[model samples]
Target chain A: MAESHAHTLDEVRAAKSRALAVFEPLAAVVGVGITRIGDGYGLKVNLREPPPSDTRLPTEVDGVPVRLEVVGQPRKQ
Target chain B: MQLDSARGLKRALIETVLTPFVSVGPQVKILAVPAGPVAGVSPVQPSIAVGIGRKAGHEFQIAVRCQRRELMTGKEVEQIRRKAKNEVDVRYIGPVSKRAAPWTQLRHRPLQIGISTGHVKVTAGTLGAFVRKRGGTDPHILSNNHVLANENRAKTGDAIIQAGTYDGGADPADRIAALAGMARLRKTEPNAVDAAIGKLDDALEFDPRTIRGLGKLAGLGAAFVDEGTEVAKLGRTTGLTRGRVTAFELDNVVVTFDIGPLRFDGQIEIEGADDGPFSRGGDSGSLIVEANTRLAVALLFAGTEAGGENDQGLTYANPLRSVLDALKVDLVAE
Candidate 1:
């Protein structure tokens, strides 16, 4: 992961766009949310489960730090 | 990539990825997930969710929902991932539904589901759900204001009937409940719901657990719905029908009432299969629920009939959250 760095709202949004495009296809991934980490912004990728640290997912996309956040999908009753 | 500006792009991307699987054949029932955070997932990020199901006659059952077999091979799923610009956050779920059962004859006068019921003096409308006042055990009949309160023309203590007037309910023979409260609909004011409730004259005269075709009142859903949420409802005309939420945040809708045309705001819309409608004229007042969880989501009131066709046009509703707040009621759990 990159050390904490200063980021503008515009940069954070750009990161979201770039990250969304990069991760759109992986199955079981649910959503991409914006998050605030320390003084900079981070991207939170929601998934059905926690991905392995060595998975194809990147630690950063478009110069923004990314983190995996497990978000279980709603199931049929 | 402001969230607002990127919304359209994201929606298009998901649509492009799923378009092929949407209608591979008539056996499939698929809809686009709205661009928003998938509910129950943390951090409220933007993403799309797909709801898969099947429609059977008057009922849309979700028992066959999104099985792995229905979705096909892993290669196809991989193809969707690649086409989606590698934006891997797409979410999938099995959305299910239960049909509202038609009302049948019972020897007792206890109010039954799937039968005609409305304001005693007013014509008729479906008694969509049975509810209890917030913090109170007294049961009440929930329906559209137009049905129980005559579009704001009725008063508290007015008589309500099991078989609506159209079904010949009159005087004391069919008395079931009385108008207790109603959420007002305004012409110039922004309105989010069109709901009303009547207090049952006697608890023994009614059974709150059963719906006409739908088995039992499960419970209330805790949140708002995203596009593609599978839902079902029971009404007087249509009996029971199910479909998906096609759109939302509809402000500036002009609906016709007995008095005249009234404008409504912030409504949700549901659409059935291409072959038929999800609701009909007397279906207003039906309650929409998540097919699988049996959780309540919307109140079905107004619908459009496209080009004079007998089938329901498009069904519209108020989010259940707003309805509960406006009416000060809670779902009566069995």
Candidate 2:
């Protein structure tokens, strides 16, 4: 993936805002931000652990794709 | 013919004997072994034996007994013999190698960045960079509060040491600076940075703007950049590593501290570029910079062991602008 974006920075920010509003309250979620998805941009949701098998997360937010990453707890290096 | 008669002739012979095998790789060692009864050499004749060995990976010892004899070509061996004008016995011996050591863990005079350093009461951390209070003349050592200030437990005049206590640095002996200031880490509120500085001691000398391998800082980098922007860092534990910005404006990054877990917002996230981790324990306070420009990017403070795609873990850093603004300091760019 590259930093060059198909979507404007504003689009990514708006998408991030929507992702945060939806994912921030979840106990499993740790962080939310904009990330590169293939050749384009998307909202990245960092989870403390994998969500339930039956759990459903949006694949896209406001036309931007959503990528879920299972990043365990971050600690001071 | 006296072997020691001409220094130039001796140097030429040595160069000729070793030149052809230079491309043979670092695993091969050419030494002058004592003349002894060996195949193709007379028992009474003193001969030059070229011993080629293989290196045991990551070990200090070499396996001189190499089963791959074809590594030494007959043409190269003949060239060495022809250069010496004497019988040269070229053979593969047991492996022999020297382990590479990390120099950043050692104490150095005129302290350099990317070395083991921390508060006298703390175990160890990295000396990230050098800076000065805005409009100030004196230089300061920059690092995490957990490093130079013992996580807010230390006072302004507390001693800071190089090589750190965990690396055997002691109070009054390895001391190089005094704590100047820190961006206090709050327990209940979100924090923007985990940084602090130490007023450099008058007696010691230090390079105010250079990193060990990355060269001098060009200047500060943008706090917000694209996710895939490449970056690099030099630190105590990991030495130097390359990584790519995986996430930006990362918020709610909960970092476990000595006091407790604290939430950080608008942080930068990095993932190792080539399957290795970008940073590890004891690497806190490392300065992250643009891989191509060497522009200061961020102050690395936290990381995760797993959950990244590369399996090498993820690193978290505070934007350099936030760190400097919080501490009221500027990079000593000169």
Candidate 3:
């Protein structure tokens, strides 16, 4: 059987089913360069190998633009 | 020797022996007209000579028989007319090169051979061998003139069996196309005769990227060689090889001796040093391509013959489009 990642789209909805307001980790955020080659996302992160956990706001970490989001979970330790 | 039947044709015959470029043939003829204008026929450019004899003979006898050709154009013909009273006749010029028509029609099947042990298989010699279509028929191989001519020994349909590569790669000659006209016994003046094409078949499929790059023929470019410009080729004896563009175009060749051939257009030669800058011996038929663009630029052609006789190991090549126009075919590998 093929192993499935709970991080799948369905799991995301289940995790936030009842949450009306919450904060989530800014996973990916990129910006647009003048040349605009590929889409410029404000931020991007790898859950498999997350960057050193941060507790900062409006961060410019790892060349990615970040902003806070609502997630109802405590940034999984 | 009589003034008419046996004139200086004997001496001219001797000169032809020394210079293959101008030889006497059965159809050879020369025309003589007074530098003075003729009354009826428009006085044409001084008399001309055509068709040279290959063997030794008297010069006087030869002057009477060859037709002279016009500048670069093999069309215009000037025939001999009795010289007017006391008027000196002018000498005529001959054709750029002598060639024989090919007998057998070309075979478009892929030529296969092993570059490692000269092994023979039923496939094109190796990968990267240009698989092209012949006159819109079967697929063929594209290489340099030096390669398929096999040092000028073989002709069209001469069954180019498999041979290993310059390294351990496949043999390039396997996929070579047989040339028709303009290629006979290899001449020397226009030093580079490097380009040659082959025909491929339907059964064989190839990756255009790996085989040959398809692009528009550059009408004009920097003309200067750009460093790091990638290039690739499929040679007759050497198979396929790649390199970087080294320098700018150099002309006005200061020829030292009669080294059989002169230009190194697609020879993959770089700056100065002679001795086939990169490929040697059988690598004569390969194509030179710019690295990323894969633009077919040069056609690999001649190198030094025996004795390293022409010590200037410089190789020669012909530009690519000339190859296409000369062969009257298109690059099917785009």
Candidate 4:
């Protein structure tokens, strides 16, 4: 686990925007959010399943880490 | 050994080994017979098994260990077997940890929070909390639209019942409230909350500030909570469970509703603490509160089947402020 350099909330928000723009359009991607990575801020890309190996997901968005998480499809509980 | 003698030995073991630990009080169950075969003991052997069961996440491990060390040793078992003058195998079963039983589905008097409740047309869901119009004194029951309004199908004055229809609640007889209002669910557009309210019946009484297991509500929390914040909820299906904010400001979450697939934006995600689930079916209307402060954080509405670190699944919620604003009510808190 790596911690990002101290970044402002505005900077993280900007990074989230950029990450969502890229990930949200993909069919496997379900959600994108600003989450705590290590002790700092990063973008979490929630996917319905693991993306295809050919699919190129961003490792970082504007220097903020873009961590991928595979959360199953959400249903009204 | 004769069956009668074995029974006597079982009672004696319980008195000597289990009774002294009763003061520990962690929802333990002591059984004389083992449900399964003990490791080194033969199935045909006449064994007086002493089993201790505890619910997961309970703080009684040290006490259980002490009991095991003090009274369940091989020498103790041999001594007991010799005194009984029989080939009795005394086995010590585990302090097995399991989930809490579902008690919220039972019909309650005085309307307890976190019990089963729903619209007459719906199956069941949890009573999230109590709320009132800003500056108004009349209390209202708060829950999800799907719980109290049948996901926009219910009318303004539709009957809301305790224990819900799935749990044997019938309209008119179990009616506790009338559907007052709801934040309608949109088919195509993105939604923020799935909340509704019911006007409390004049004859009914409820504790405004207390949630079933979580105690008193402090007040409203911030609309947006940061990740890693510890939270808890008591619901119809799962009772009280704790978790952590796994993600916040989550966007583009698609939820499957009875109407159709609906899109939601800017939601919060929670993962159960200790690999347990925070919510389940019939738990759709639980209120997520900050663990320490007890401030209302979010209104639970949806969840995933199998994902995240929790073996059960991840839970999603509407920010409490958003739900209150959408419903035009304030939480009735002390």
Candidate 5:
């Protein structure tokens, strides 16, 4: 879900220098980043292409799925 | 009650209110009495006096707040003046008092947020907002860099709008930064810090115009939702969506897709049907803003392969608390 800009003067006044404005509202859930550093040491967000209904995730831009090798004995998450 | 007896009433009032301060012992006492006037009654006015007993060096004091009332007819009116030294903070003891302020019920925990970067052309579904790095006591606007811009270099006053929701303020493409750009994050190659921080240029711009409006500076990150907490957000292609937080502190996420500087997060999920949560394509960079304070919590990142039938609302978010700390900003009002 998305956030809106509907705060009371008192709420906004205190948040005067903190909140960022969002104009667009997409129908689906995308990326949420915690910027620690890449450009700066802070959280950032990113939106990318969605997977096709038939395709699984962890693929390259060309739609090639990835492979992984477990370093240690796998453990439950 | 007698004049001395009235003093007893004042003592009762104070002790009744500060019952939950933990530091205060139960031995505390207060007394209150009536000491005012009634327009249609006798000359004897009615009012309340409060008092507390003190021993040697340790002491106690009482305070009373009054209101106009028509309780009894005044029978006698006389001047009564008494003076006593005070021992504690007493004045509008309603707001912060324990009897007055109670703890809220716990509802929902943190959810994972999936983010995409059009510029980098990579997305990380397992990405999460690391709050511990910034300490638990921070509050500044927070989000992934890709959420703020297609390019990593947004100006300090660049407009950052939540494109995932129906916003009625200045366009997100037209907001200014209070701190420009200064977020720190941990290095992905090793244990590091890499996060973004922006100063809010305008504090009272979005405040509602009403008697009960609270116009203050508020930042994003640490955005949360309760179980069954209905909320929404707007993304690149999806427009606006709705869901609730179902879990928190989900870890051991490994994004298998990579594109040089770009990352394609394939394992994340949001608003799923049965194949995991969340819809896909162009829904990145959206902030999961909560309803009450309208604060941003999850940076719309990725969706899962599961559907609602299999618990589709497993969305991820970069908590706002860590972002606030990196910016050296205050997360809560004192």
Candidate 6:
């Protein structure tokens, strides 16, 4: 089995921070998180709704792709 | 399943099914697993998880936490499984209840943190910790708002007792502080804390340095708790208990109070030591601190319980920094 190289937790966090800094001001952004992707890591930008085509979030940061995720009203539990 | 779609399904299930069941039977939690392991079986199917707690247990396994499996029959389990409609796998885990219960006949001295303190009108809860108003000489006692204020039922200068009203502390014999301030809790909004402070009486011989079990006062950790950070607490019900922070940065956690259901965000959840629970009722006010440095971290509040011999339960708390900031107080340091 081949070992897959992955971004360290710190690196993933930095990418997330950069993504949040850019998209957090947008009205659609609700929260941002870092999660493991196939072999590296990706930034998950939570949105209030599906992002429009003109959303400011980039395709990648620090070699990590940014994934747009939509969230809803908070759950009770 | 995608996280977005999974959350939507969770919302629907809770609104239509779990909420009604919980309203009738308070000892259950419905968990939605978009994808995860269950009882060592990693089923790819998006499942609805139900944890039915009976008696408290030593091992806090989430797969099936029943105190006595015999208490829950095979028929009842099948009935629940049948109702799922095959859209999701219904996973049932019966472990012990982690609810904290009130202490019985425990004696505590005055002016000590980690002892009982509650509104004169209600059962006793822990004193939690002590603090001072920023730039002020007066010392204040910290605890849950439910303890000191009786869930907003108490007014300014309401009497607070050392041993809690449940332990027979009344009037001049036990009164030690007066309610000062509290953070308002909202039902639907994201609340950061359930906290209050009491002004210690000038006449009482109070010592803010020593906790009942963990002696000497220390500073607090303002940073967020990472997963598996070692923590401990001293309380009236269980004296001293230790655990590890299982998870944090949690949002939308619904905790039931006597007033009603309130949702909290950015909360920390602790899994207790193998021997027993880290806290119980009457321990709600206990200060959760880092075990080694004694760095005050979280304020112990709610736990779930079942009728068992161990009486162990998982404990939830508000971050110490949030509590302090919300109440505009600072931890008293040596």
Decide which is better by DockQ, 2 or 5.
2
Cα lDDT of model 5 by residue, B240-259, tens digit? 45665543322223222111
TM-scores, in order shown?
0.54, 0.73, 0.36, 0.73, 0.32, 0.58
Selected candidate, larger TM-score, 4 vs 6? 4
Evaluated at residue B172, the lDDT of candidate 5 is: 37
- Backbone clashes (count) for model 1: 20
Interface RMSD (C-alpha) of each candidate? 16.5, 11.4, 31.8, 7.8, 20.3, 11.8
* Model 2 agreement with the true structure over B108-185: per-residue lDDT tens digits: 888877888888877678888889999898899999988888778899999989977666688898899999999999
lDDT (10s digit) by residue, model 6, range B128-149? 7778888887889999887788
Stretches of model 3 off by over 4 angstroms after superposition: A1-77, B1-135, B151-153, B164-188, B201-208, B211-268, B271-277, B302-315
Residues A1-77, model 1: lDDT tens digits: 55568765567667765665687565344445455555765665545455655667777887787766443431100
Query: How high is the lDDT of residue B89 in model 4?
Result: 37
- Per-residue lDDT for B30-75 in model 3, tens only? 1211011112323222233333332234423223322343422322
Docking quality tier of model 3: incorrect
lDDT of 3 by residue, A1-77 (tens): 22222232233223222111121243321110111112322221111122347744333232333222221111100
lDDT of 3 at B24: 25
How far residue A58's Cα lies from its native spot in candidate 3, in Å, is 70
- DockQ measured for candidate 5: 0.02
Number of the candidate with higher lDDT, 1 or 3: 1
The lDDT, on a scale of 0 to 1, for candidate 4 is 0.76
Q: How close is candidate 1 to the true structure, as a TM-score?
A: 0.54
